[model samples]
Target: MKRIFALFILLSAVFLTACGEDEGNAGSSGEKDTINFGATAGPYSDMVTQAIAPLLEEKGYEVTNKEFTDYVQPNKALANGDLDANLFQHKIYLDSFAEENNLELSEVIIVPTAPMGIYSNKYEDIDSVEKGSTMGVPNDPTNLARALIVLEDEGLVKINEDVDPLRASLADIEDNPKSLDFVEVEAGQLPRLVDSEDLAAVPGNYALAAKMDLLDALALEDMPDDYRNRVVVNTEDIDAPYVKDIKEVIESDEFEEIIDEEFQGFGKPKWMEEE
Candidate 1:
């Protein structure tokens, strides 16, 4: 009878240990000592490797970066607790993605982001863009709108004033003063169009991946603050210690100094600029 009682106690202890682990790991990958960070395979990933990870290491945190070639996987990874945090998407995209996926995620902080730009192999400047020239724009709705807004800013096109600029599309163009012909292509494939199209509107990330200089573009989009890429985590882990640590590392002067030195053409987020 004493042996039977002892076995019961041992089983109960093991069950309790398993329950505690489940509760602790409910919202993230079961490790607190190491962070699983995800980003698209480009400048943003470089930001994590070059700037953020060193400071996180100083705090005794190990950062493991996962480079995804496309946009869909990062958030999916975060939602499934395969990643603790990620840094390649803007707040707008994060909100939209979370809503669509029914995932609870939140932005911890925004980071300096590369802006979309108008690149040309033939033209030296916006003024040199010939009328009726072919322009390559992102086929994806979000970035297509961004490209249109940049065109409107450069007086190349006029979008309908009634539409929200964020939702603007080729159909929303009320006027084509330059008679510019827009070719819609995948955003990543845009940099390749630079040599073929008269002008190509390339998102900053893709341009950097293609080794094109941001400053070399004829014009860069003046993006809204929310459009800047942000560090994101599961909303359940929004108040986690590691999230707080990530924010602290980003807000430090060391992060900005690294940005100025390495990420020169990237635009600063409003929070950083306000300081």
Candidate 2:
């Protein structure tokens, strides 16, 4: 009788322990309480994962970093609920992308703008650039307009006042004093053209990827007060706790320090403040 009682007690204890273990495992089975962030594979994404992710993790939120190569998929993932948010793209690009794709994504925060620059292997300086030299610019509509605007600002070319910044093309150029040859190439291919073309207006990311010194570029666009840098999320998730946490972490002093230290004047955050 004593042996039977002892065996029954042991069996009861073992069953209780098993039940507890199962409950704990079940509680942790589904998606973690994580903020899924999407970014392109570049300094921008690296900096965020290194400087920003750890901070959020310290606050008890898991961080998942998703890398994208193209411009469209990140926003699409956010809109489709595959991602919690995205860190790439500026407001201009985001708005245009949404309009084109029929997405209803919204900007949750403005992070930083990578000042666009024009790089060349042939000319030592912008003044040394001769008239009629071939110039390679991004073929994308928005960037094409931006490149033309920069040229216009430098008195290198003149564009019609009626030309839309998002749709401007070579046909919109009203004047080209040097008979400059404007070559339209895909954005990714523009960096490769630097070896052949007299000048190329390259995005900052591409310039960095090509290992070119950003400071060596002959000209950089003034991106201050430009609505071209932002992080976006679906409208439904804008008010989520994790999304709010991400916004705070991005706007924190830590993130700013990382940007200043890593980018060395190339990237800077521009967060909106409450009045």
Candidate 3:
């Protein structure tokens, strides 16, 4: 009986020791309070780690960022739980992605990315461009409409006032003062066409991807607040405390300082612009 009792004690001690080691290992991994974040490869990812993550740490949250090279994967990773949240795209892209994929993602907050600039390598400025000059624009819906908005704002073209800005197409153009010939190209291709087209409207993300300077562009649109980039999360997490905390941090002055210091015209905040 004594020997049996001793053996039972030994087994119990071993089991407890094993369990303790597992707990210790988990703590050592340093992911207990960490949030997995996703962003695209340029300034967005840099801002996440350099700016946002530090703020999250101050609020007792740890952030680990995953950077994606292209547009498709960040959304895919977030939808399937590979990422806790993603901060790379605007509302238009997120909404269209959700509808098309039947994935339920929700926007946490609108983050200010840089405006889509109407760039011209051929002409020195909008005024110098002659009538009937070729224009390069994005063919993708959201960016295409975004480009049109800039063009119209610059008085190079006009869109039907009734059309939704997100859905506006060439067919919606009410007038073309320059009789401007628009050549539809992929969003990524517009920057490459700077020397060829009279004006090419390029989103800041694509501009970054193409290694172009946003501040050097000739004309920028009066960017609407809705056109701002968004930080998004799974629909189930829309009301989560951490998500709310994330939004608060984004809106804070600390984050704004970081944005002004790091991102230049790309991913610029409205508050930063005011300053």
Best by TM-score: 1
lDDT of 2 at 72: 81
Q: What would the TM-scores of all predictions be? A: 0.86, 0.79, 0.84
- Minimum summed lDDT over a 10-residue window in model 2 is located at 23-32
Candidate 1: pairs in clash? none
Candidate 3 segments exceeding 4 Å error:
1-32, 267-275
Q: Where does the lowest 10-residue lDDT sum fall in candidate 1? A: 24-33
Residue 127 error for model 1, in Å?
1.7
| lDDT digits (tens) for residues 204-253 of candidate 2 | 77888877777888888655444356778888767766778878887887
lDDT of every model, 2 decimals: 0.91, 0.77, 0.83
Please identify which of the two predictions, 2 or 3, would achieve the higher lDDT against the true structure.
3
Indicate the residue-level lDDT of 147 in model 2: 87
Query: For residues 1-275, could you state the per-residue lDDT of candidate 3 as single tens digits?
Result: 99999999999999987786566223444333567899988878887898889999997776899989877899899988888899888776788889998999999877768778988877878889898899899998878888888888788888999998778999999999899998998888888888787778888877877888888888876777667878899999888777888898988899888877887775455654665
User: Which candidate number maximizes lDDT?
Assistant: 1
Deviating ranges (above 4 Å) for candidate 1: 1-31
- Pairs with backbone N, CA or C atoms under 3 Å apart (clashes), candidate 2: 90-228
Model 1: per-residue Cα lDDT at residue 6: 100
Model 1 TM-score? 0.86
lDDT by residue for model 1 (210-259), tens: 99999999999988877899999999999888999999999999999999
Better of 1 and 2 by TM-score: 1
